[model samples]
Target chain A: MNFSHIDLLSFKSSPSPQKPLTLAPWRKLLYIKQEYPDNYVDESFLENLQKNVNFQSFDYFALCRESTVITEHISSVLIFVAVFIQLYHDHLDPHLLVSLGSAFVFLGCIIWEWCLARPAPPMHKSFLKTAAVFFLTLLGLSPILRTLTQGISSDSIWAMSVCLFITNILFFDYSSDLTYSIQFPGSVALNAAVFACVLLASRLSTNLHAFGFMSFALEWFALFPIFRRYLKRIMPTGHLIQTLLLVAITFVLFWPISRAIAVLYMIAVFSLTFICPIWLIFIQRYKNEIHGPWDEARPKVHRFRSPQR
Target chain B: MPALNICLASDFFYPNTGGVEAHLYSLSQCLLRRGHKVIIITHAYGKRTGVRYLSDGLKVYYIPGLVIYNQATLPTVFGNFPIFRYIFIREQIQVIHGHGSLSPFCHEAILHARTMGLKACFTDHSLFGFADTGSIITNKMLKFTLSDIDHVICVSHTSKENTVLRAALNPLNVSAIPNAIVGSLLKPDPTAADPEWITIVVACRLVYRKGIDLLVAIIPRICHQYPRVKFIIGGDGPRRIDLEQMRESYVLQDRVELLGAVQAADIHKLLVRGNIFLNTSLTEAFCIGIVEAACCGLLVVTTKVGGVPEVLPEHIIKFAAPEEDDLVRAVSLAIETVHVRDQRPELDPFVLHETVKRMYSWMDVAVRTERVYYSIMKVEAPPLIERLRRYYGCGQWAGKLFCILAAIDFLLYLFLEWAFPRQNIEIAPRFDHKRYVEKAVWRH
Candidate 1:
């Protein structure tokens, strides 16, 4: 779907009076001392605002609009539960699953290196090597992390894990491009996830279980996000397929539980995904985001420094 | 009309150096001069905790709290309610005026003040964009805080417009009040007899938003054309490298002086040393520095962005588009205009005095703010219809949600007072009432 048109459509709906906006007494410029003795808004204002309300329905149709968000969240939760079920049933050895995930991650990194090596200059190769070494060091330190939280109580661990998960959700930088310089939000979430895994690993009875958890952590925290971003960028259709497959797998795994609970969860998630878009569309009827000259002017950076210092 | 006791609440206050912090201090002092008691409630900074007194008997209470990024205190929404109530009762504060949008402390204070049935006024000192995630979240939070504010104050007409749009508030409820600098502090130097070199002084934090990049990009081209022109850049930030690179790129070592950061006291002296005050900031709520430069009798060459154009009259300023080429052209025009001028540049103190007086005065702000207080108190309770009207305008779902929040807040206030009756709570006396001079003359 082309997003450019939607933006244009939204912009065109602005209250365009015949006179030039600049010369008007109510020019949005913040500097002048204009007296608005009476109320700025009225029934007429709301009536004017209503012109753009119906546009929301077309922009945010149920089933189509919110399905992407719901699918991703649901799939991630299902994948986690599936991994735990496989561990409990011993259908797949934890160590083997851990090793497979680690190998896949390493292979993904190699692919990334190969891809970068084509377009990037030789100088950038050194930076990529440094990044590789950094990841290697992190992998080397994983075992130490597994044992670091031995002294903490189980109750504390449970509370800490919950806090970490919430942090991951709250601070997750949803921007697919990762164009921001800081990326503090994504980094914080990754850090919290790493901390949670380390604390959880310490409770494991065997070194194998600890290593399995650490490897799984690397797959989930580091590589999965990269894969997700790549898929989102390239084959977004595959994401839908993956989401559906995960849902089917979760339903099959949780068949032993009362069918009602599974059905209830499905109904709730489906309603949320479908109903939210409608709600959002309804709400958009009143989304009169007032833009005036007083709002801060965004600085456009004309000069971009070459990668070379 | 009697002088009212007013409390100015903000996360940023004295000892903090910025346009907003300075404005708060000077305005509070001016309000004090009007015989109105001004008290400030801000988060604790350094060792400046508990009750402290500044010049002119202006009282400040730096309540202890964890200072977050850029000195904005951690926002524990309902935590400060009890202490705030105590302070309000003790000080006999008729008005609660909050400052700065980033200050969640002030927002919380305003909410609590409204909940306590006190008149609450808010002053937004910075501009924000509607785009970007940070701004979207900030705007939402601002709307939540501003939903029930009695009146809103902005430093400039631009700021007022921005605030009204950003918070979805009624424009009539908001007032455009420009910031003022001490005209005496920034007086033009009469003693120095330097050559008529077109010295351009750029004094601002060398940050991306300040348009330091624009200045850095244009300075070299400007220098090559006009050899008599010299540049003095002040303030330091992450963008120092860009400026340094530009300096080296242009090989303008002797022509440009980079005084990494200059003290506030030296700003006036430095400003007066230059013929042109160059501001290339992309965004400014109300530029105090440019006003100070104007006050110092410097010919202004500034980007006509944000509140810069509104700050100075067209005759006094040479305005430029916020582009490198335009700024250079503007500077050239200003230099040419100065060279061809027959009379000495008008450094009329009266112009500034009138401009500043017309826009805002601390006493005027205090009086305006005081009216909100009495309006809230005079009524037994806010009518549901009025509440619904205000809330309904916020947004569709948000309007209904806000109406619910307002109702909950109103009920919570009654429940709190009833549960812990005010009669049982003893009010503390004034900490200190030291007599001071320089009371502002009340015009009314």
Candidate 2:
């Protein structure tokens, strides 16, 4: 018999009370054999089969709203690529890019402080102190990094950087929980981005160019995600605006390099942000997560006083 | 009816002591008593290898394999097929019964059994959730393994539900047969004259999933609520340190006793010392430990999780939500009830023992299990195309993948048959058959 077609709800045992059917009181389980056959699926067999009971329905708009985080993350990666390409081509000066990036980072910190609803600290001193220490470390490491992959071919270096950058974007933590100070996606993602930055920086001629790029990469990859998380938490509208502004800036920067590529990137961004959510909603009808009394219970424990009390 | 040769496959057995191991041994013994030839096939432990016979002439084949975490053999698909085939041919096995979901050996055995066109039965002993990544992968594997199996058995109704969802098996094919205790071993101690202090016993592996954290959190509160209460914990794991730390920080050294890992034989003795048996497990399929404790006349107070609530009648058990405060409240109530009952002397240990004996026994489980076997044997093996059709409903890509896997397994079986002809292998001598005697059923 084809067992898959056996509908648990429909397969009732023959109710004919023949041969003095020992009708025992209905219990969930019993060792003593009842008159029913071994395969007799009673009415209560699938009574607890709860279908999609714990399933949370998704609203199209809310889902689209949530996809904004993915869009923002992709936009940031694209903007960083655009900036790196311009710097590599010598279309943008290293000193000017570093100064502008630092200024934006400072502005971002102030907005982040406001979002956190905290009185701003003496920003210039702490910011400069952190920047000084970061730049000093980068300066010391720039020479080593410049020659780290000196023997490798430029094509291999470029290919490896692309893969690492893709890894960075794929593993980025986009979960809404921002309570953790360390952030999700943890060290593996950060290491991938930093390795990609080091690889890209090695292509530059001078140590200072590599140093500037590395510092900016730190601010972009490490600090920017924390800032984005705070912005999303504090002002959702500002978060959307930030995503849009980043996308526009990336498009404008890349338009000069290749118009077709810039147009394709924008289309990809829009499709990922809008079309994906619609696709998710369309597929939500197929979501059939079956949960019942069988699943392991998550323990809920609160603090208890010491026995000495 | 002619008796059939059955091979019980699992990673757990005699050398290793666990609930599944005991269940397998007892079930095999009972099946043997009922005139069916049964042999166990498990991974070789430390030095024990090749075929060995346990007491009552039950044969065990300890196949040499790489033992990984928790003594489960590393899942090398098709690695054990040649030896398994040889064993099947040598034993002239008709049915292959696999136990324990976590046992990759059992899963592989079931897969190979179906490839060889033998009737395969699986017994799931634990509950699993669908949320976690590990569970997702395991569930998919279970679905693949069970796609073509003839029958599935679960230790509890909750477990039956879980296995059905995990493997997508027909509910009719999956029987809810619970693990049973040897009722004779758990006779209650009647010599303890004074019941002034209410001792609560907890004997389980102190793992996170076993709710050791909840146990640690509630111990202090429960002890403080009732001054006469004392805790005796058994079994040890990585979380035992946390429990010890809790005891130290709470200064409960005198009141709470930690008897690190006790033998299975000593559990009944421990339960008899305590008036209440506490189970703080986050999940359980069919808690044989709780049943054994109940058989020893200890009032059971357990979290209402998994198959625990259905294991015992409500009157003997006090249910608590799987939370620290709720467990404390439940244990406190049980302590009060036990204390009052002790004063009245109305609580009969013999009655509790009788109730537990009636509820669960190895012979009963074996009888039910044998019935499942009979039912499955009545039906002939479905055509390969029909089996493939069933597997094709698993998922889109997974269905195709499973079909490929099933086809490959079939080809491998053909290759093994060609390489080592079944007639070339020597058949193992069977045990002398005993005449079956019907024991009178004890009814309440």
Give the distance in Å from residue B131's predicted Cα in candidate 2 to where it truly belongs.
Answer: 3.1
lDDT of 2 by residue, A1-309 (tens): 357533332222334546434677556664444445444556776577677887777888888888888888888888888888888888778898779878888787666555564532324547668777877887898999888977888999889988998898788888844533454565567889999998888888788778778888998888888788877886899988988898889899889999998999999988987899889878889987777777667788765543453
Q: Which one wins on DockQ? A: 2
Question: Candidate 2: which stretches are off by over 4 Å?
Answer: A1-22, A31-35, A105-127, A140-144, A176-181, A303-309, B115-117, B192-196, B343-346, B382-395, B400-419, B433-444
Q: Calculate the i-RMS of every candidate, to one decimal place.
A: 11.6, 4.2
TM-scores of the models, in the given order?
0.63, 0.89
* CA lDDT, candidate 1, residue B423: 75
- Model 1 chain A TM-score equals 0.64
lDDT of 1 by residue, B1-444 (tens): 576788999988878778878878888877676567889999899998999888767789999989878899887776777788778877888788899989988988887787776777788888887867988878877998887667677776666666776787766566555576676566676344146577888999888888877877788778878989888898888998888888787778888889988877778778878777899888887787777776766778887776677676777678888887778789999888767654533534345334544443455544444444444344343355665566667777877776776677677667777787777767655534433232334422
TM-score of the A chain in model 2: 0.86
Scored against the true structure, residue B92 in model 1 reaches a CA lDDT of 81
Candidate 2, residue A102: Cα displacement in angstroms equals 3.8
| Candidate 1 accuracy as TM-score | 0.63
